[model samples]
Target: MGADELSATLWRGRRQLDFLLFLLETQLLHLRAGNWHRLNFTASELEKVLENLRFESLARGVEATALAKEWRAPDQFTLPALVEIAPPGVWAELLDEHRRALVSLVKDIDGAVAANISILEKGPDEARAGLDDIEILATQVNIERALAAVSEASLPFLRDFLGLS
Candidate 1:
């Protein structure tokens, strides 16, 4: 739970966020292209990443708490608080960088999700306009199942990130 360990966790979390953003972009492309199969796969991948992020978040909380206690900061200190109290050199700068990058990544993810939702709101007829009867049925089933699973698992994480709960 030292600064180095906390830094490593932050680094890993950033990479995970980057991968999540990539998946969101890919999911949006598949939605626009009407590639239901790939979209389903991406949805599953997103679930896995979200699960990993949940665990990573717990680990980060523990590490951050320990570091905060070591530094004599108040309870439930935020990354910004940590940055403010960090030794005035590489650690302070690095933590600030991580915080900024995470914020930007979260905003990008939010934008991508909004775009995907907009395309989805256009309805199945527009999305599946070119598909044959069988393809439409299969796509509908697969997309429904995949999106339901993702939405169920993703809502809490999104809510937490967006400070909704």
Candidate 2:
């Protein structure tokens, strides 16, 4: 695979990561509110996103491997390694940015997962107290903000896929 193909795959992966993070955050909110119904739906959606991410990851691996071979790098190259061996130009900088963003998203996902687990482990009264501490208005605002961010982030991918100028 060429650099352009690898770049496109990376973009798709990034979008998937963004969506995954949004869903996880939404799930956390639902968990905090003890809204099992909405949480179930969000969990289902999260699974779908995870599956898509898996495919994207495979494609990325293939493309990265090809690029590595083209650049005479080792077979088991990681993103950091790719960045190191990348030509001194835009591609290198772009790949490094992606690496950083992916790392941050993974960390955020971990935190959300841990928080959800902690809430689930709490006693009923404790959980209720936790929920009481959250402001309904603030949760609504956060949901709206996350939705807007996801939609805005998706526009460039939509335009590119549709061949829009």
Q: In candidate 2, what are the lDDT values of residues 14-63, reduced to their tens digit?
A: 78878887887887777677564354366567667866876876787788
The positional error of residue 111 in candidate 1, measured at the CA in angstroms, is 0.7
User: Could you tell me every candidate's TM-score relative to the true structure?
Assistant: 0.82, 0.71
lDDT of 1 by residue, 117-165 (tens): 6665554676667778898787777676556534543435433432434
Q: Cα lDDT for residue 26, model 1? A: 86
TM-score (C-alpha, index-matched) for candidate 2: 0.71
Q: How many clashing residue pairs, candidate 2?
A: 0
The per-candidate count of clashes, in order, stands at 0, 0
Give Cα distance to truth, residue 38, candidate 2, Å: 2.3
Residue 125, candidate 1: how far off, in angstroms?
Answer: 1.0
- After superposition, which runs of candidate 1 have C-alpha atoms over 4 Å from their true positions? 127-138, 145-165
User: Distance (Å) between predicted and true CA of 98, model 2?
Assistant: 1.1
